[model samples]
Target: MVALKSGLKIRKLAATLLLLGSSCIALELHTDPAVAVDPVDAVCSNRMTLSVTGNLKVPYCSNKILDQPDLSVQRAVIVIHGTSRNADDYYQYMEDAAKKAGKLDGTIILAPQFLREEDIESRNPGNDVLFWTNDGWKEGDSSLSTSSNPRPAQVSSYDVVNFMMAKLANRNVFPNLQTIVIAGHSAGGQFTNRFAAGSQEPIVESTVIPMRYIVANPSSYLYMDEKRRVAGTVDKFAIPTAQEKSNCPNYNEYKYGLEKLNSYMQNIGVNKIRSQYAQRQVVYLLGEQDTDPNADSLDKDCPAMLQGKQRFERGTIFYNYLQQYYGSTIQGNHTKVTVPGVAHSGRDMFNSDQGIQQIFGSSPNHHLNHPTQPTYPTSTSNS
Candidate 1:
């Protein structure tokens, strides 16, 4: 009996010890390393992807804070690439400028690819699916190139401009918007000139909206007439008084694509600028050296820009007409900027510090809510 009690007591003590041991144990779980996170670092990695021309490209610009723009920044400057289709490179250059100016977010810089033939085309990209057709300004997925079969609902290249204007008009789209600038180079410049003169869209005529254009370094300029200089020194008479805006709805060659399609002009129910189109704000930017004897040489027979001492010199003649005789008569202002020592390149004075202020430069002027506050300085840019 004594042995049995002793054994029972011993067993009881052992059980108690085991229970206490189990209760005192502390458990710790190990987690995956990835579970340890930092919020700031995650935001730093966040990036936006922009796809243009059916190809995915990363604007991939620096995340540095952009410019703190005022109401003046309510503008969209759309740039069109030349025959080289070097939109990407041109975009990068503008991006760098924007970054420097700190207006990266304030301004919307859009560059489109105007694809041309292999003879006129070069090493840059030209194969992406087009988002727009140069045809009469349709909106939405552009129809396949005529060279392409069974077109995909033909949309006009002008459609993009229309779409952009709508986006700007909606405060929801750009709350801080005030002006819109359409800019292009080389062939792109050609598009700007013709479209400004004969846009199939309505925004071209709306005076309430501040719309502007910058045509840079185009080989061919839409001449007001066949006027040249008197021995490259003084202004002679304008050739035939060939008014640009007066002649409209004639595709010239754009009709090949614009024929029987949606146009900004057609949508507004007018056939000519005199009937419907308003005098648009236009600026011409040129390289002082792009005066190739064949620079403005589209054809020799009919000349808006005749054989002159310098290409720039000839361009100055057009600028003078639009400003002195033309724009002033209609109360519209035209800007002319000459690039010193630069030839056929994208970096012109207009896109520079002196030029940005020249182009978009405005101080805190009085006379609120009027065009007077942001008066543009008089420029002598001829070509």
Candidate 2:
């Protein structure tokens, strides 16, 4: 199993996995004969929902995740789905890692379902698979329209995060709650990066609470200058350069629209949304062994063009660039570490304690619990 990166994304499922309203029953999912269920973290999986509001209905299943016959963990961890949408596998791997690291009891793991277009509220069109149903909801093109479609609807799939954040932030839900980790691998890693880069959730911003984001071996990145007009290399040029006629032949949609980008920022400002991005602590977890010669990832995607290089190369390059140009602000704040002897497997990096500590390491003298202490914008990318 591999955690995916958002920039390496494809079409997303559109339906809801669990039914809404208070009339749903919990499900008990188990292990396949192919994989051995570790005796320590062995338990069935549970179902949860993500609504537009902060309200989330968590199913209390007999899974090992919630069964605290023993106390070992002190924080709540939320595991998101990858491009394959195999969230169950992600949960299982996370459980295994937690148990191995002796942090199982302290961590509460939830895998939110973001089905494809057919799954979105059950808009199933005959044979079109329903993602929200019993799994296997591959990503799809369920939308169009610039302002109306992508902004709210496409982004809506991530609404599940809002639901989960509300719970972790609420002391009542997690009495002994002390830390929270948002993690993903590969395609899932891509999502973690974009979400961290864009998410403006206040629950994450209100405290010195370390809103740590971990990205492992994602294939792509949504470049800041994704318009394509800036060719070869971009960092050497000035900020916000005009797109020439050659690149991004049709710059409106292929490249995130200039107007749309402005609108997004404007709306946030007008709406007075608090952003943790400027100071958010993010870690790029690249697998030392993972690389694909043929894939949309590491090719012509936002990150591909953004870095002027391949996936892993760019992540490393960007990390160095930040440390170099933004050294003053990132002073001991940002970190970029590489995982050893690991390929592009989801289980590899998600289980990395060293990587986890890089973003959310706790000590008597650490202040990961502060508010959105803004840092000036800095730029760097792998070339």
Candidate 3:
């Protein structure tokens, strides 16, 4: 009898251990490190009321409020997020960059979140909160209107930046603010490139508070003309051949080229847009190692392909095109910065010494003095 009781206890112990082991396996399957967490799952903590066509709320992450006055604030860096709509993460990146640069005390970091229709459906942020189609915000398209979220007015994504600039330009609020830098990576980079060209906000022309645009590693660039880089050529450019144009009919559209202008861009004439872009302080920040042709997020369409085979090639070609197009006029206002051994990383790009100088350096020509190329670990993820 004693032997049978001992056997039963051992058997029960074994069953308990087996059950715990199965639970561990299930947990491991659920928490696999290989599966990336979707950034859109996280929402920004702060909201700003934008009075564009009408009053509407937009989500953003900022270290300081624009409405409140801070005497110590000297510079404002608005870092736009990538396709993930992860403004909170981008805000942290810029904040970390500012801390490393020793500009944390006086620099204000802002990351505005551009929500998608799905994000709105899942999150149910509010009825009046602005949201756009998955890719529309990148092109400065109007926010969407649905039955649940009836629209008071159509608001362009670029108009949000315009409103923010006006707020920053108000002397009563940011009396000491001297410079405003609009910087973006990936899809955000595309927005900054086009916005720099097409934004007609008069506050951008304010001599007291000068604006600068940092376009880093965008998939495609907005060309001023139909000119595209010739195949196998370093800097040479030509209009697409008859055969090439036939293969890709809409290659010269608004996002890739200047054919069909959007409502926001339509308001500003082509000549004025090009002239303003040439005069603006612009930086083309490229990663030396961001040359992967098969990058997961790289735009594989014909229009993007016409620019170059990969991100690094496209960036260099665009800079060269600008040099050829604008000549001496762009010399002082525009510059290209290549970060060594970094690939498709906003954190590495913004935290690099060159990026810090571009964001925080007091001298107007500080970016012209290129920093020594330092090797960094390659990042394969999209920025």
Candidate 4:
């Protein structure tokens, strides 16, 4: 007979077996199996929605997060989904990693959905939901103009993060929380990088809790200057000649360089934003196998080409360029982590040994690459 753990209710069915030569007694028993459930699914069977204001319901998941009985959550991991707008999928990956590292009990996992107009149209979330223009949300821009529906208030995608952080910062909501990590890969990575630069949220300043940003394998980066890496200087930072800038004048525009700023970042001076960004904790996670110069969704614009032919190269160039621009006086607390054998993938990048350490704070040295390797941008890959 197998003894079950206390508090476990079980039912047993038994049968007797007979032998040919002699009477024999055998016991056949049926017992209920212990079913391990995912916290995300257990707590939120479906996506949970947060109303930003009157009519806009932003969908998200908080994963038992800070509401567990007798459990004090101390850290949170906010994972931003990629262009696919697959928040649910991204949440699962983060949840799995947290569970693997035994941090699931104390860590909150949040994944916010930024839907496109097409998604809104298909779902017809009524007038109560908010959706952004195609890729407008990525730039932290306001909702798109719709001919049928009068613009539903002017809320930027970044505002969603600000709103969530405000809730988390509330002492009553997450009293035990001491740290928050904002991480994203691919397009989400681009958002995390830019958001960290100009975010006006005071949550980062909360004396009680510190926040960290993880920008992983973004296709493009927002350069702080008009200068770009010369094509020939493959491994080093070399600015384009005067003639190159002359040929591509608009190359320094927004999203590429700090030239024409968007409405969200226009008022904030570039120097001010750079200064703020320099003082924060940032990690640049690059994919080592993302070297396809002509990969799908590689941002083949002339501006992106100026950075590098591939994602891995561009990330390396950008990190080095920042160090040079900021100089030695106030160097930012930025660390580079490399994910080997992955390319343009969010799941693999976040679940790797390196991802576990950086996001959940376990086995910290497992992610560090060799010192001789280009340590500026730690290489990661997605397969």
lDDT of 2 at 338: 81
Better of 2 and 4 by TM-score: 4
Kindly list the per-residue Cα lDDT of model 4 for residues 1-383, writing each as its tens digit.
00112221221111111222233311111111111111111112233334433545666655763333323777778889777666777888899999888888888888877766655554554555556654566667765546765444556677667666666666666767767788999888888988888765442322556778889998788887766776767445555677777777777777677777776666567887777777767788888898887565566667777888888988888887777777754333777788999888888999988888888783121111111211010111110
Distance (Å) between predicted and true CA of 178, model 2?
A: 0.4
Give residue 336's error in model 3 in angstroms. Answer: 0.3
Runs in model 2 deviating more than 4 A are 1-45, 50-73, 118-155, 203-208, 222-245, 249-259, 262-275, 296-299, 321-328, 356-383
Q: Which candidate's lDDT is highest?
A: 3
| lDDT, model 3, position 372 | 20
lDDT per residue for candidate 3 within 193-289, as digits (tens), equals 9988876434232246667889999999999998898989959989999999999999998889887777667667788888878877789999999
Compose the digit string of candidate 2's lDDT tens values, residues 116-171.
43223232212211122111111111111132112122222233354455545554
Q: Relative to the true structure, how large is the alpha-carbon lDDT of every model?
A: 0.43, 0.44, 0.76, 0.66
TM-score of model 1 vs. true structure = 0.56
TM-score for candidate 2, please give it: 0.61
Count of clashes in candidate 3: 0
Show the lowest summed lDDT stretch of 10 residues, model 3: 374-383
- Candidate 3 regions with alpha-carbon error over 4 angstroms: 1-39, 52-54, 201-206, 363-383
C-alpha positional error of residue 376 in candidate 4 after TM-score superposition, expressed in Å: 36
- Best to worst by lDDT, what's the order? 3, 4, 2, 1
User: What lDDT tens digits, residue by residue, belong to model 1 across residues 1-383?
Assistant: 00011123555466556646774421110111011111111011112222233322111122221122344454456666544444555555566666666676667665544332231122222233332332221121232444532222333455444544554455544556666666766556666765665543343222344666677765444433234344445466443334531342231222212233233434433245433223555677777677655433221222323424444654576566445335455334456777767666665634565446534544211111112111111111111
lDDT of 4 at 142: 64
